[model samples]
Each structure stands twice: as structure tokens, then as C-alpha cells.
Target: MYYGGYYGGVGGTWFLILMPALLLAMYAQLKVTSSFNKYLRVQSGSGYTGSEVARIILDRNGLHDVRIEQVGGNLTDHYDPRSKVIRLSRNVYNGHSVAAVSVAAHEVGHAIQHDEGYFPLILRNNIAPIASIGSRFVWILILLGLVISPFLIEVGILLYVAVVLFQVITLPVEFNASKRALYQLENGIVYRDELDSSKEVLNAAALTYVAATLVALGQLLRLLSIFGRRRD
Candidate 1:
């Protein structure tokens, strides 16, 4: 998750800096949801279920050891690098719709990236633990600094820098996965006419990541502004 701290008492001008990013994040969520649902109702011409498409792509890439499993929740699909597993939501794993295959293939794209040690993906994985900690504790530290010690605010800012770095690093990883996914679908699974719709689905999903990065960046700017003003 590319989440950042919510500075509740910040000046209104600082809030203004974050508002546009928040709006984009909301729009991105709606776009992806609408695109996915609309295409989920439209069956793919190949008629292969999402799981089958995943298997085909994985085998073609010589990732025979990677496994697919069904998980609960809508749009909860992901590829776990540590476990070497691709988890799909029930609808994605069983559905034979255009959206289903597109998402399934996208997760397989991540698997292929992991197998080939894509630099961005590798860097993201390496820093994920620290970034996770930063996102979780950053606000707490900031709030405590306001009441206890200004030094804690500096520490909080350092932690938030890590969170922002993670979000920035994620952009390339996601965009590359979508690129790989589109290529795989165009080769055989998706029909020529259906390729555009598949691209729409993937593009909508990609917007969410872009929006997240923006939100993280906006929040970072707010934090820095406040810290600098306090010092002055």
C-alpha cells in the first residue's frame, strides 16, 4: 500500500497541496471498478477461464513451478514473490471474461519479472519491509513529536521519505507488468478486436498506482513544509 501520514492540524494551504492528489485517487478507483465490472460481463472470444490463461502464460515463460490459488475479495489479485504464488480472486480465477484474463495475465507478468530479477521489482522488494514500517508508524511519531519533542518530528520525516521512495519505485514495476500483460494477451489469448478493451482494463488499473504515487508525494510535500516552518 502506498499510504502516507494524515497531518490533521496542518494549515489549510498545506491541505490544498494534497487535495488534488486525493481527488485523482478517488477517480482512479472508480475508473478501475467500472472498467472491470463492465468487461467482466463480456466473455472473452478465446473462452478460456482466467486460471487457464494464467497457466498458459506461465508455462510459456517456463515458470512451471509457480502456482495459482483463489483468494477472497474482489480485485485482490497479486503475485507473491516470496512464496512464488499467484493469488487471484474467485471471480478472476473462475471467470472467462476479458477482464478476468487481463488481470490474471498481469499477475503472471509479475511472476515473470520475479523470475528474470527485474531491477525495479527487486529494489521494491528489498525496501518493502522498511517502507511498511514507515507507513505504519509515521503519523504516530509525528503526533508524538508535536507534544513531546521536535526531534521525533525529524525522525518521522525520515521514515516518511522511505514511504515516498517506495511509492516512486513502484511506478516502473506496475507499468512494466501491464506492458508485459498486453503483449501476452495480444499473442493468442485475446482476439484482435478485444485487445482494446483488455488494454482499457489494464490501463484503468494502472491509473490507481499513478494516483497512489501522487498522493504519497503530495503528503510528503506537506510534511516538509510544516517541518521547515516549525524550524523557522
Candidate 2:
């Protein structure tokens, strides 16, 4: 009878387990931001701006048509497949810091993947909307089921699976981006000195994805445990 409460599930353990990862993610994010800002002030000795790095990288990958444009903000860089544009945040686009070059080059990696039609990247783009919808329903369905019939719980379980699938798919896409960024850095397309710093920043960034996946996995497990306890 006491276990009837949905909170009786793996909620506590799930949170506890993910607590450290969440803390680490926060720390990593802060470190990256601090480092980026710090490097932002250190002018690049090579005189190559973010757009210049992006241009050369895209040209190398035969994505010469992908326009690299500067948008306002910090760390707001991304590659838009729809517009065929690589949008670089103001600081990254115009600055000649290690942060600028690294962030800019990383976005170009996505463009390269698009040009070559990478499978994981393709899968991620396709499933993103479905996953977004599923996430919107997951919490409500799951919590509602906990307070009502077990059937709602089952529905929530199915929905959470969709979210997890997206998380799994994202791992490859992100890792590949970092790998490509590193490759570009090593090839002299971007420059050294910033190599270690870029690597550190990217490494921190990657942990965010890992944290997200782990959170999803925890939720999936929580749903499974709820179902299991219902049976028992």
C-alpha cells in the first residue's frame, strides 16, 4: 500500500546517482565559459578571425557555399542546414581568440557532416522533433500515472524510450563534431597554442551530452522500476 505512491519508485536513487554528474556538468560549463571569456581577450597571434577559419575549413570539405555569418551573443554559434549558413556569435565571429577559432571550427564540422551525409547526424536531425514532442509528454504522463492507473505508467515508459533513443543518437553526432574539430586544429587549419585549451573546452562541452544521456537513462530506469514494483 505504501509503495503505491509513484514517488516510491527509483526517483530518489535516480536523482542521487545523477547528482554528481549534474554537478560536474555545471562545473564544466562554468569552466568553459570562464576560459572562453579569458581567451576572448587574448588576441590571436595568427590574425585569423572566426569567419576566416570557418571559410577555409568549409572550402576544404567542399562546402564552399555554406555562408559563415556573424550573429550577436556569446557562444551562440551553430550551423543551420536549412539556411545553409554557419551562424557565429558576435564575439566568436569577430574575435581572434583561441575560443573564437575553436568554437567557429567546431560548427564547420557539422557542415562537413551535412555535406558528406553522415548517418548519425542525419538520424539526429530527423528524430529531434519526435523526441522533443515525447519529452513534453514524458513528465506529465509518468507522474500522472504514478498517481493513477498503471496503464499511464506504461505509456510513460514507452515515451521515455523515445527520449532515450534520441539521447543515444546524439552521442555519435556530438563526438564526431569534437573529433572533426580536433582534426582541423591539428592540421594547421586553425593554429596551435590554443590546441590544449580548445581540447579542454570541447571536452567540457562533450560532458553535457553525456550528462543528458545519463539523465535519460536514469529516467528510463525509474520507469522500469515503477512497472516492476507494480507487478510485485
Question: Each model's C-alpha lDDT?
Answer: 0.90, 0.80
Candidate 2, residues 135-197: lDDT per residue as tens digits?
888778767777787788788778778788899998888889888988987787555766787
Say which candidate scores most in lDDT: 1
Per-prediction TM-score to the true structure, in the order listed: 0.93, 0.84
| Candidate 2 clash pair list | none
- Residue by residue across 116-165, what tens digits does model 1's lDDT show? 99999999998898889889998898888777877787888888888888
- TM-score of candidate 2 to 2 decimals: 0.84
Which candidate has the highest TM-score of all? 1
